[model samples]
Target: MFEVEVKYRVPNHDAIRDRLKALNAKFLEHTEETDIYLNSPLRDFAKTDEALRVRVYGDGTVVLTYKGPRIGNVGKTREELSVTANDLDSLLEILRRLDFREVAKVVKRRDIYNYENFTIYLDTVEDLGSFVEVETMVNDKELINRATDEVLQFGDKLGLKREWIEKRTYLELVLERGNERR
Candidate 1:
C-alpha cells in the first residue's frame, strides 16, 4: 500500500469548512492521532517516493489507511487497509493495550477520492487544522514514482512543502507549540 498526502497552509479553516458544506459534503470524525515516526537506517525520505508503515500498536483498534481519498476538508475517503484479528469484540479488547496521546474521531464527508481505485473517506480533526489525503496500493518503484509525483503535484498546486508538513502528530503539535510559548 502507498500513501500520497500533502498538508496545505490553510488561511481560514472555518471558511474552508463552510465552503465545503455548500458543496454538499462533510467530514467524518475528528480523531486525535498520536504517531511515532520511525527512523529508517537505509534511505533518505526527502527524495524517496515510497514509504513503509507497519501497525506496531493499535493494530486492531485503528483501521490502517493506505489510500487517502479526500480533497479539501470536504473530501471523502475509503479505508484502503483494515486490520482485524479475530472478532470485533476481540479487536476492541486488543485496542485497550496501546497508549494514545489523543484520539479524536473523524467527521466524515461525502465528496470524492481518486487513486488506483476510487474510494470515499471521512476526515474531521481538531487542533491540527483541516487536511486531506490520497493513497494507492502500489509499491513498485515505477508505481511509487507515479504516486509520489501525483501527490507532489497536489502539494505544489496547494503551495505546500515537505518542510511545512508537520512531522509531529497533532497531539504533539499542540504540545510542541504550547511549550514553545513558555
Candidate 2:
C-alpha cells in the first residue's frame, strides 16, 4: 500500500489542535517516537529516495518501516511497508548483521488524530520545531493521485497554507541542520 501524505511547517500547534477539536476529529494516542534511520551498504538510499527506519514508540513498541520514493508532485505519496518487531535490540542487531548501518535519529512528540479517512499528526521534533502532517493509506496504484489530493485538501481544511508545505523528510532536515553546525 502507499502512504499518501502532506506535511506543513506550522508555527502554532495549539491552533491546529483547536481546529481538529472543532472539526470533531477523533483523538488518538499522543506518544513520543524515536526513529532510527539506517542506510543500506549496497546503495545510497538518499540518492534512491528510499528510507529504512526503526521507530520506537513511547510505550516501547518497535516498528520497522521502509518508505519508497515519492510518487507525485502533489504530496509525499510513497509505498510504505512496516512490521512490528518484538525485540528492538535484536532487530537492530539483525539489521547490523545484514550490513545496514545506522545514520540518524529523530525524536519527536506526536499527537495523532483521525478525521474521516485521514490520519493527522501534530509533531514537535526535538530540534526541528512544530509541524502537522495529514495522511491516508491507499492500496491501488491508480488511487495514488487522488489520495494525495485528498491529503492536501484535508491539510487546507486545517488552515495550512500551500506555501508552508515542506517536502523534505525529517531525516534530511536533521542532517542538514547537523551540517550547518559543522
Candidate 3:
C-alpha cells in the first residue's frame, strides 16, 4: 500500500493532543518504539532514499517495514510494505547474513490517535524532540495524489503550519545531525 504521510515539528505536543481531543480523535495506543534501520551493502539507501527497518514496540510486537523513495514535492508520500514478524532476532540475523548493516536506531515514545482516515502519531523522538505524523494507506497508485492532499489538509486541521512540515525521516535527520557535530 501507499503510505501518504506528512510530519511536522511542533513546539508543544500537549497543545496538539488537546486539539486532537477537541476534534474528537480517538486515543489509540501509547507505545515506546525502537526502530533499527538497515543499509543494504549492494545499494546505498542514503543515495536511493529508501529504507528497511525492524521496529520493536513496547508491547513486544515486532514489525518489519520496507519504505520506498518519497514521491511528489508536497509531502512525504511513499510506497510502504510492512508485516508483523514473529521473531525479531531471526529477522535481524537474516538481514545481517544478507550483508545489510545496521545504520541507525531511533527511539521514541509515541501516542497514537485515530481521526477519520488517518492514523496520527505524536512522537517524542530521542535527540530530535517532538513531532507529529499523519498518515493513511491507499491501495491504488492513482489515489496517492488525492490522499496526499487529504492528509495535508488533516494536518492543517490539527493546527500544523505549512512551514513547520518536515520531509526528512527521523533516521535521516539524526544521521545529518551526527555528521554536523563532527
Q: Estimate each model's TM-score.
A: 0.42, 0.97, 0.96
Positional deviation of residue 108's Cα in model 3 after best superposition, in angstroms: 0.5
Order candidates by lDDT, high to low.
2, 3, 1
Which candidate wins on TM-score? 2
lDDT of 2 by residue, 33-75 (tens): 9999999999999999999999999999999999998889867
Q: What 10-residue stretch in candidate 3 is worst by lDDT?
A: 72-81
Q: Which regions of candidate 2 deviate over 4 angstroms?
A: none
Candidate 3: clashing pairs of residues? none
Model 2 residue 180 distance off true place after TM-score fit, in angstroms = 0.6
Clashes of each: 26, 0, 0
Which regions of candidate 3 deviate over 4 angstroms?
none
After superposing candidate 1 on the true structure, give the runs of residues whose Cα lies further than 4 Å from its correct spot: 13-81, 85-92, 95-112, 115-124, 157-164, 171-182
lDDT of 3 by residue, 1-182 (tens): 88888999999698889899999999999999999999989899989989998999998899999999998887788888899998989999999999999999999999999999999999999999999999998988899899999998998888899999998899999899889899
Error of 3 at 83 (Å): 2.4
Pairwise TM-score winner, candidates 1 and 2: 2
